[model samples]
Target: MTTPTAQTASSLRAAGREPPLPFAVTLDDGRELVMLRVLRILPSKRIVGEAETAGSRMLAKLFIAPGSTRHWQRERQGIEALAAAGIPTPALRHAGELHGGGHVLLTDFLADAASLSDHWQAVAGLPASHADALAVLAPAFAMLGRMHAHGLVQDDLHLGNFLVSGGELMVIDGDAVRSLSPGQALQADQAAANFAILAAQLPAGWDEHIAPLIDAWRQDGEGLPTLDTAALRERITHTRDARLKDFLAKTLRDCTLFKAEKTFDRLTIAVRAEADELAEVLADPDAAIAHGSLLKDGGTCTVAKLEHGNRPLVIKRYNLKNTRHALSRAWRPSRAAHSWVEGHRLAFLGIATPAPLAMIEERAGPLRRRAWIINAWCPGEDLATHLAPYVDSGPPPAEAEALRTLFATLYRERISHGDMKATNLLWHDGHVVLIDLDAMQQHRSASSHARAWRRDRARLLRNWPTDSALWRWLDANLPPA
Candidate 1:
């Protein structure tokens, strides 16, 4: 039986979040660092955690990949460079080799600091033009401006890299931070390319509204233009498209975000941090389905809600009726695999969907058979039932706005939900979450998308009587195909 290993960083990362912590590691100088909680892991390669040294708390990075000298040196140099350039970064406290192999680095832990990523998430669901959205984003761009003025560039410029402490923004992730030219403002093109990296991380429709905040990216002494230029926006679009391509690829592999195992006979993958909790379900999904509370038992698929620890999860099984049905689906990717990939795609686009946790497929050499996909359960009521009372009248304010935003985003991204019944849309946490995404697609060609979206739009309208006030309002409000 092939099972997850215990000691290697790879298996430890695949272990569920809250893996046996307070792990001790001896430094080259004979001092020991006891890690109590992990903050992040680059599976099989590195780990960042909160640790103790002689009774004092600090942050530590363990570069566990064998002979990981190149990354270690770059990290050391990057932090040192940020300090030299007068950027506010976590102060480096220690750097040395681990007792046997790999390397370790330590830095001061800011107990009160919060990542900009968390702050952004609080306002991300708001309309793109809302003041709160701009408020959370301005400081990040202003901080990036300061880095540019110092000729510093962070390749992965996202909210998580900036921390809020004592009413100030502090930069981290030194490994991705480097210099174009020290103590000199970046040239026009160089600054655009760097800024685009950050902009690409923002939600869709934000690129059009960032013009007002362009001033924030120009520090008092940067000697840069105040206006948002056309070239910069175009660069942001290009980068964003390329990033989406890269992210979808990560969904199927054993990366930091996922733990995957693939073979011609079988394929399985799960959220890296939750793999351990989901092992029993993965080891024998049929047995799990037999014991679970079945939600559906159809000819094509079956669904059941189950729990691991305190977290509720939904598992879906794609069934084959008989030999003919099995042979037909054998040559194609299972619907379960398709939903897994599409779920990740929706998340990357900032669209709402049940968080995909795992995917499994049974195969005969190159041929596929029964398969399953698991998702974090969404407990919200379906849109059809939620709106039953509002059929004669329009939806409430929150529902109205959320519906607009969801469709507008879909139109902007050229996405079409193949089955547009209201039952597949769930009213969740102040937004409408998309479900049953095996047939969903984001079209590349504008003309082709229009044709498909017409079908989707008309299908949704057919859900209600033509004369219902809700139906009329949606027809007028929704974006044209």
Candidate 2:
């Protein structure tokens, strides 16, 4: 943290700038709030951070945008509503205009608290029906139900908006909390629609396990509004589809999750969290690949293992082969970009894949040439090698269970791995991790997906002989077209 120094809101709002911490912004009351750690920022719009004003720590939200009073007022009103509606929220401690042209809002800070999103990570890999996973989520939905019963709704309902501190599950992000039809419980349709946004946060096909969670909601709900389970399911499917489209669209732009740069001569995008760790490699990928240990250096692609700090990374370069081949692929998105997006998609759906770190495309104007994708190295062996000993018999129970789980998710989401070769499946930590995702596709149409699913199933089974026990086992166990 930097020493406390006064900074102008105008200066900090310049294009893509942020105030250096720990910096002070004078409040309308003439007291200085010194921010020590930045949490999240929307460039020139607003900034959230940890701050102190007079020996007390609080979460400070500086609405530094050109017209921020309206937003600041919404935050204050929302917090007030939460208290009036008997919903738990951090007490509003400070609300005032910035010395310059913005506003400041501060609330009690819970240093030991964790967001539901953070807690959910621990049990997210477990089956959604597992008791532990349900326990973590049940309370969050119960809180939402209580809000609805009290005639309030969290417009942007997600796990992150709930905080667990001192054994209390408290609602947060007052800006998202608002009232509907004052003094009356939310109608069944209104409540279900709001709940759909929250329900869609879980993985697809977990809907069967969701009935129990609604009971948890009913326990806290007032007036006990009847919810149509079928309608809720339909709403969830549509919300999930819309969310997937929005997330994929964000992949090509600069956003919180990704740092992207597009130029006529080049295209570079990296997972924002990995930007500092992989800076050297992202700066000059080809140079790093040249110095790394080569895994495969011919054909349509080249793979290499590189040592970065204490970690190992795998980089794959999609070779141009010839000028003719480059021309054929010029106008379309590069294969590296496709792999990067698909990798994130799989990870988003809770499927296993090597964590994609970054991707770059060498371009001349609008035309693309060679490209490279960087991923965290997986220590597990490929299925072809790992299962070589079990060819005559079925694999171990753990391995079989992992494959079943992976394919179940793929089928539920209508995801098809175009290349289902044994080498593309890696056995990592008792889970099957998919790689070589350049041709992977998640279908939007059921009919098109059925056709693609058939081809994938056949290709996967082709890895073993027709009469082999392992092949027969998979042919029967795996989901069919």
In candidate 1, which residue pairs clash? Answer: none
lDDT by residue (tens digit), candidate 2, 85-181: 8888888998999997899999998998899999999888887779999899999989888888888888888899999999999999888877886
Candidate 1 per-residue lDDT over residues 1-481, each given as its tens digit: 2321233343444554444565777777888778777888765578898888887888999888766888988888889988998889999999988876778889998999999999999998777758998889888888888888888889988899999988888999999988888878888788888889998998778877877557778744366534447888889889998999998898888877888988887899999888999999999888878877899999999999887677888999999999999999999989998999999988988999999999999988889999999999999999899999999998999999999999999998999999999999999999999999989988999998999999999999988889999999889989885
RMSD (Cα, Å) for all candidates, in order, is: 4.2, 1.4
Backbone clashes under 3 angstroms, per model: 0, 0
Compute each candidate's TM-score over C-alphas: 0.89, 0.97
Please state the error at residue 75 of candidate 1 in Å. Answer: 1.6
lDDT of each: 0.86, 0.88
- Which one wins on TM-score? 2
Which residue runs does candidate 1 get wrong by more than 4 Å? 1-38, 52-56, 64-67, 97-102, 219-221, 226-228, 263-265
**Deviation of model 2 at 381, angstroms:** 1.9
State which candidate has the highest lDDT. 2
